[model samples]
Target chain A: MQSFALYPFAPPGDVAALRADLRAWLAEHQPHDDVVKRANCWASFDPDFSRALGAAGYVGMTLPAIYGGGDRHPLERYVVIEELLAAGAPVGAHWIADRQTGPLILRYGSEEQRERYLPGIAKGELYACIGLSEPGAGSDLAAVRTSARETAEGWRINGQKIWTTGAHFSHIMLALVRTEGGSERNAGLSQLLIDLDTPGITIRPIIDMAGNHDFNEVFFDDALVPHGALVGTRGQGWKQVTAELGLERSGPERYLSSHALLIALIDAAGADPEPAIAGLIGKLTAEMWTLRQLSMSTAAKLAAGEDPMVEASVVKELGNAFEQDMPRRVRAIVDCAWDDDADLARLLRALLIASPSFSLRGGTREVIRGIIARGLGLR
Target chain B: MSDARDMLCDTARAVLRGADDIAPVEEVGFALLLVAEGQGGVGGDWGDANAVLHIAGMLAPDIPVADVILSGLGDVSMPHRAAATVSLMAGAMGQALALSIDHVNTRQQFGRPLGKFQAVQQSLAVMACEVAAVDAAAAAMAARLDASGFDADAAVFEIAAAKLRANRAVGVVTSIAHQVHGAIGFTEEYDLRRVTIPLMRWRGEHGNDARWAQALGRQVASFGGRGLWENLTARAG
Candidate 1:
């Protein structure tokens, strides 16, 4: 009775204007003609597109103005990202940085580091990647063996990070490394902003099942960085990383990756949505609604300046299913394929290719579930 | 917002927890459920009644107090039942019954926990689906009650729908829970014995699923042919 429409995170006042401005902006600037015409052909190394986003001030609309950001609410950022991703914008270049890294740096980065990184990130001129998952670490940060040896110059990093998205095209990596070998598994871990082109770092692409050039493995052999590169503090990387994850995992992107396809699918059905079709839609809509409320509650928890990791995981775990299931559900509903012109055919195709990454990229569904179970007082 | 309802629930929960060690309670459970104050376990109607049902669920995996309350009211009180309580007066979380069943440690024929069986899990999951329906219906109704006064017309449909959906779970989830527990599930000492009996008895008490459905359908046809989905919302609002 309240509203069937879920995930209306917009505050009542600015929402209408925001939606109008966004729709107009999106219509005027469709994805690069090539992207719209075909799907799965995205190249993550599109700097020109990134720069255009910077000029439009879409990259970092929520950070403070002094840092070259619009200093808007995260809710606005949430809606903007949903619209961009739904429209299939070539945001791969700035995706991680804007979504996770920028926020990480803003919230926990040292003052000088923020001054250095935030403006560049807001401009979309700089790129960033997370160097968290190690070769043997699995999802357990406690297992990380990446060591950062302190040098007079700063820190020398030596370890390999795997499953890092956009690692091949990124300019910098905010890496997590163990600075001390004490029994404290979480202690002694530190975050270093390692330059990808540094002397001892190598990046190699690891093609996924979809043959996407999105993810890569990185070898950090004594990579050098000044002391200022240490985000937060040494031995505090574990805390900083966990906090950053709360931002990374929660938000609209969790459920909206398939929204464009869902909308198009519904529009194709016309006025009387078939009962069988409506059942699927109703089920999907309900699941999405639950995840959105959980996510919004998480965001509300964050706005109150709490960790919200457990809540984030619950949302992400559920959210990923809703996102990943969309393409398969569309296919199952009526044997629809990537080439159907009923409406936004190319967009549908993009979802087919991109849906697999929905769970793996942000955090694997298994990992999210682990967080959720632990949150629910499980082992 | 009512203090009486809040206290009634607290008492119900306390009674349910302490009920585990007690012998199978078969002494006109409804009469005991509505003694007005201090006559037996609980002492109020709908709110107290269903709160006992929900808490009873945790202690005794198969208890159908939720359904019993709904149908008892539906059969005896008639119109008031339609206006007042939905099976969803029992506040719920997502897939609550399913998730709770996961913790039931009863062993099956295969020498494993019943939860270890896919068939049993699926059955329980259907119960979870019903619980989710209740979650949706209850959330909508609660939000309405909070924002404005409840409208009787809208309340009838929501209560009927919620009862129709969630009331079914008493038979479904509790039955499976008992099946998993075997003969012990029905015994006086086994803790959750009354669950199935109450759920089954309650289901057909207030005219069964058919009766409510017919009324709902007739009401739909009464309003100028096309279903008044929006008019229903106006009452809800």
Candidate 2:
């Protein structure tokens, strides 16, 4: 009789054009000469590359033009980030600031704060890191003991923050702390924009098994900031961080972490792959395609200003599982000898070491499932 | 969820309710839900029939609802049994998931429920992921079918992906569903085997994971990388 559709049949024309522009820019500017560095992709920290990207106006696209952003829709930014990620571009330097922090500030920052940080962030000069996970409280973010006491100057922050990515190099820390003390889990929390160089703050790198010093444990012992440091409202950190996480968990980066390895697997397999190997490739492609659609749909929701907490969690949970399983599955298909010089072998080796943290970084597998369970009314 | 689609779904559910046998379902017009108008039946599209397929799957009815519905679309050469097999496996997985959850909570080992064990929970968690992925894929396929008719060449990738992913999921879901049930699931008398055996048999029908995967792989290869991304993100307009 009659058919109907819920999802879009084709991407907006502007999005397709943006995709083409990004593809061309990446081809001309990306340093494809260094295989290992390129293999790092989003995790590779190259300030110069980020600066060039900013100059090209690919960063801070979703913010208002009044604050030096492109003032485009979130879907536009989604397109750019997806291209950068799939190509394994070195976007780590501005990844956090551009992806979520700038948007967070745009949404909640005071006029002065926006004028102070948005321009620099949009220009890709400023960098920021999330300050949610603590040594005592990671998945249980409400258990944050980092206290932000009222001071005549502004706020004095004291506590330890762990798993803070880009903390050492980043200029700002969106620290979540206990502003009003009580036994309540999520209340009494506030987000403060802490300058990393502020006094009494110490950042020591916690090198991962891959020997990458990307994340750190910061000791915020009475770190001081001026009155303009508070983001949104006091006692609203939990709410703000929850929104920020929706941005974090529902992007193309969630699933493209192991993309380099997939490409390498293809090259190693050659045109004539074994039937079993082809089958594995097919499985990976199908799952990735499905997750990609789900993620893009979530981006559409976010662009439409809908809070898709449940759908975002689905992306992270399923995406991370597929990413983490890539190395194992590729190993099954190819003869991974773990030689450092061979490209395929080296990529597989790096993925093997790095894959364990895929689930642990955004949210642990157990914690993500709990969120999904709650969403599904199973909990 | 239009008025017409909603009514058709209600009628289909009512007609197929408790239809452990296919004869009664055919006696009603439920079998012609996908038949086009003027074809001696009420006309409906793949999108409308998708709801019926999903509910039939969830209810785990033995009637060949998906098959009969597919046979009505005279132009397409799709095997009716293949469509039925997909829904059957999906429904069987749902039943297995529900049954295994109950088994884990009730069956005890070492004076505690099996679900209390960390290992068991982790396994169940993985199984849950598979089920979720399959569910999402099915819904996505339905939406895609609604937007672009199933006859369009563009729909092949999604159709292949959905069937491929669903077939792949059944293997993992059935394994874990059985693992958690232990010997009880292996026995013929237990209700779990009934669902598991059909799932095992359906896993090979209408082209299994490997078959659909090959089709998907050829399409991706022909399109190359850039076209591949276009195919993936084109749904966000």
Candidate 3:
């Protein structure tokens, strides 16, 4: 495996060009009209905004051009994502589809599946959510009790998924479930692509403490799907899902969740804030800068058709610590209250509420640390 | 292909592995990796220099690697030394972290190894994180040097960041290593002080985090947010 470079190379010329074009478009399309709403950033779901982004060809840059994508490098997509997250753009609606689902389908889905889903995904008309975590399976996804049995016409999925973000608004779900029986846990698992509107499916919203309807508990009771719905090979779901999980962890989203708060911190600190506060800002910014470079390097490896599982996990674990730590540091430095009317206060409150989930989502801290230790051969 | 660089690194590592001294490395011209080909030295890229610096740092040699390498480049200033110091300290911190990990795992307390304790593991984890960050900062600075070729003006902000971040890491890494090793780490007999003391000395050399932070603040304030951001995201041109 290649080690992290002392100085990773720069993004390609097209990446910078695309970033400029996106910045200009954002300047006109997304202003700071509502600071609180913008604070939601990638978490803010807006179908119309997603459609606009799709029309501008910003969503699916890494997919094949024949499938309605830009056929660009992964770093190009990375540049767009970094800009969107930095400016706190409303990208939740198309984020999952653009990030992983489109690539997953392109890589693992059959011809019919790719033809049917890829175009819509590129156009941002389709939305999707992951179905790995169940009520009993948060981090231990292999323990998913969601079993799918072979039926006369197709497969019948009878189980439930929890913390399925955007499932309520999503059009499809690439669900992980058991297709085989007996003692082996991972060997029995498989993935099924089920349309959200299937008759036996139910999606209920779970409001976060931030009072945001961002999570959902999805129930699938004998939800029937055609044989074509299986992604990749049966009994290979564990391998496929773990491979894609690397994609999930390799984005700017991992660290940029609370970027808006940091910017607000700088603005609120004024020209001559206390030296201690100024030092804090510099430290946070420096950490962010280094992490961004690290993330970009991970993307470069992905583009070269390499699996950066360990490096990707490192970025996620470190990024999560920084994002979760930023709010506490800001609060400690500047005494502030949660005033809905105050911009900085609102942003701070939003970050504080959202911080707990930083390490919990994707993979929890313990799970990630274990992975890092394993990567280092310590385990 | 970096064959020469790799050879140099392997040679330096072999020479320094258990030497307990830096004299052998200097005698072999290993410290001349960055001293320019025309200057009666082995001219290599920042990457090569970094490899040598990492080895020299792990040993915490009595003979100065940064001063030897930087001084050879003619009129060496504090800022230049500061940049090199950051990379050098990162190497030392990395060595210290590895030593601490080994000590806690091997040396037992309360009928069990200290690393088995959650509190000890947590402290070690924190130390590991700082070491990684310092390593990254050093790499980033080396990359800048590779692109801009020691153009001090182009690298001022980054050099400040590297030095400041590395200086901070030295503080955390040294203290945590001491904390983990307990009494043995403080004594002269143990090898822990070899790296920790170098970290302590390097923390104040060139310029510490506070000094670099002041410079960084002035740069940010002068440029404003937009300019600072442009600087931050500016790719190698």
| Cα lDDT, all candidates | 0.60, 0.77, 0.79
What is candidate 2's lDDT per residue for B17-88, written digit by digit as tens? 656877766776666776667877777776677667766765644557776677676565443344445555
Question: After superposing the true interface residues, what Cα RMSD does each candidate give?
Answer: 9.5, 5.5, 3.3
User: Which regions in candidate 1 have their CA more than 4 angstroms from the true location?
Assistant: A1-13, A32-57, A83-90, A181-184, A336-356, B1-237
**Model 2, stretches more than 4 Å misplaced?**
A1-13, A181-185, B27-32, B35-43, B75-84, B91-125, B143-148, B152-154, B175-197, B218-237
What lDDT does candidate 1 reach at residue A376?
A: 35
**DockQ of candidate 2?**
0.26
User: What docking tier does model 1 reach?
Assistant: incorrect
Number of the top candidate by TM-score?
Answer: 3
Complex DockQ per candidate: 0.08, 0.26, 0.35
Worst 10 residues of 1 chain A by lDDT: A1-10
Per-residue lDDT tens digits for candidate 2, residues A22-68, read 98999999876455555557778889889899999999987889999
User: Candidate 1, fnat value?
Assistant: 0.00
True contacts kept of each: 0.00, 0.21, 0.11
Residues A221-252, model 1: lDDT tens digits: 88888888888777888888888888888776
Which of candidates 1 and 2 reaches a greater DockQ? 2
Minimal lDDT window, size 10, model 3 chain A? A1-10
* Ordered list by DockQ, greatest first: 3, 2, 1
Candidate 3 lDDT, B1-237, residue by residue in tens: 279977987887787777755577667775566667787778887767776787778875455766667755676667778878777787788788788878877888899977777667656666666777777777777788777777666787778778877887777788888998889888999888888887888889888777777767656655554455556777442
